[model samples]
Target: MTFTDVLRYTAFSSDPEGGNPAGVVLDATALDAAAMLRIAADLGYSETAFLTPRPDGGDGPGGRGFGVRYFSPKAEVPFCGHATVAAAIAVAERTGPGDLVFVTSVGEVPVTVARTADGRLRATLTSVPPKVEDIDPADLAEALAALDWAAADLDPALPPRIAFAGARHLVLGAGTRARLADLAYDFGRLEALMLRLDLTTLQLVHRVGATDFDVRDPFPVGGVVEDPATGAAAAAFGAYARELGLVDADADSVLTLRQGVDMGRPGVLTVELRAGDPRIRVSGEGTAIPTT
Candidate 1:
């Protein structure tokens, strides 16, 4: 595929400058993994999405289906929420909004795209069943050391845990917004620890309200220092909150996560949890970045 084959878009915000930018290749059937990686690294985005029509796939009234893969600069990731959102919108702009199914490395993801009242396209992705587990003390300590955060800086109420929806993230709650805002960390040290633990990002969060949070993601494993807007971490955090009884599990709930403010690319991520379904729903607005 040539450079023209890639589409640049930002997820979680309609304005191209405010959200996480990603490279979306609507058709990558001719490209191999190495080529995809090279393209992703060259683009210098947090992640790039590559899609190919599946042999068993066929277009229907609902929408189209494609096998999707996510590649960071250094390696392939299991899943990427922001890139998925950006790619879905990129597809909808050409194919029209409707239901979309993405066969990802983790599992099949169902996405619904619809036009907003303001005419922007919005996409919602239902995550796979989520699971939360306690992190080992030693591992947690190593991570904190890498981040230059003391254990006392963490909120005791929220606790620390490893959560997974499509990707693995170590969720750490900061006791104060100031702690979360100051995000200078040892990149190489953190990357080594994250690689050992198989973590995609460190979901750093500071609670604003019962259902609101200020969040940041350190994505060293993905070859990025930070993610402006992270959908996978938002999904995992939703599960972590529900599993910890921080939210009402028997009833539907919505959460708002504000991220990238410190980086000056503020974006918002909406997470919805239905009572009957254990899966989390992540919704965001996306738009194509204008080419100069």
Candidate 2:
């Protein structure tokens, strides 16, 4: 396919102008890795998704599945949440909404999409089973130094963690909303630390209420200064919150994450966790980016 075949969709917001924009290549059968990376670099989005049909698929959505891959402007990632949501919405617009599976580098991720009553398409993706681990003291200190944040700036109750749903994220909680708003970091330093830690983004969050949070993601490793709305990070944060008992893990819980407001590209992501289920489900409204 030609370069213009790429479609743009904004995830986590019904308004195209309000969410994280992602490039979606619904059919990438003719493109190779180098070509895909070139397209992503040309688009300059945080991440772009390239999908090829999976014919030897197992169970799910009409035996029609896709092998999906994600590439940032700099490199390929194991998975991307906003791009996943965007691609699902793109396919749903064509094939109609239902169950669809994406065989990713990490594992198979199941996605469900349906049109909302308001004429917007909503997509929910069930992440691979999530896990959380402790961060090394040296690494934690280095990350804080890069962000120009001190130990006192952190919320002691939330603590620091490394959580993984589809991709790895270092979870850090701010003591105040202002802490999250004022985002300035040494890009080279933070990117080096993240590369060493194999982290995708620093999931910096400020809890607004028991179930509301304001999140900002620093993604220097992806060649982006910051990610406005990060669904993968949100999913990992949901798992982290459940493990820390920040939410009722034994019961059904839904949390709202408000992101990108400081950057003037506000987006909302909904994270859902069910009782006895380890997998996190992240849902959001997607809109087509106007081609002008």
Predicted structure with the largest TM-score when compared to the true one: 1
Clashes of 1: 0
Model 1, 245-268: lDDT tens digits are 989999999999999899989899
TM-score list, all predictions: 0.97, 0.97
Over 1-292, each residue of candidate 2 has an lDDT whose tens digit, in order, gives 4433899999999988888999999889899999999999999999999998784644555334899989999999999999999999988888888888898998889999988897779999999999999999999999999999999999998999999999999999999988888999999999999999999999999999989999999999999999989999999999999999998979999999999999889999999999999999999999899897
CA deviation > 4 Å runs, candidate 1: 1-4, 60-63
| Prediction-by-prediction clash tally | 0, 0
lDDT over C-alpha atoms for residue 70 of model 2:
98
* Weakest lDDT window of 10 consecutive positions for candidate 1: 54-63
Worst 10 residues of 2 by lDDT: 55-64
**How high is the lDDT of residue 40 in model 1?**
98
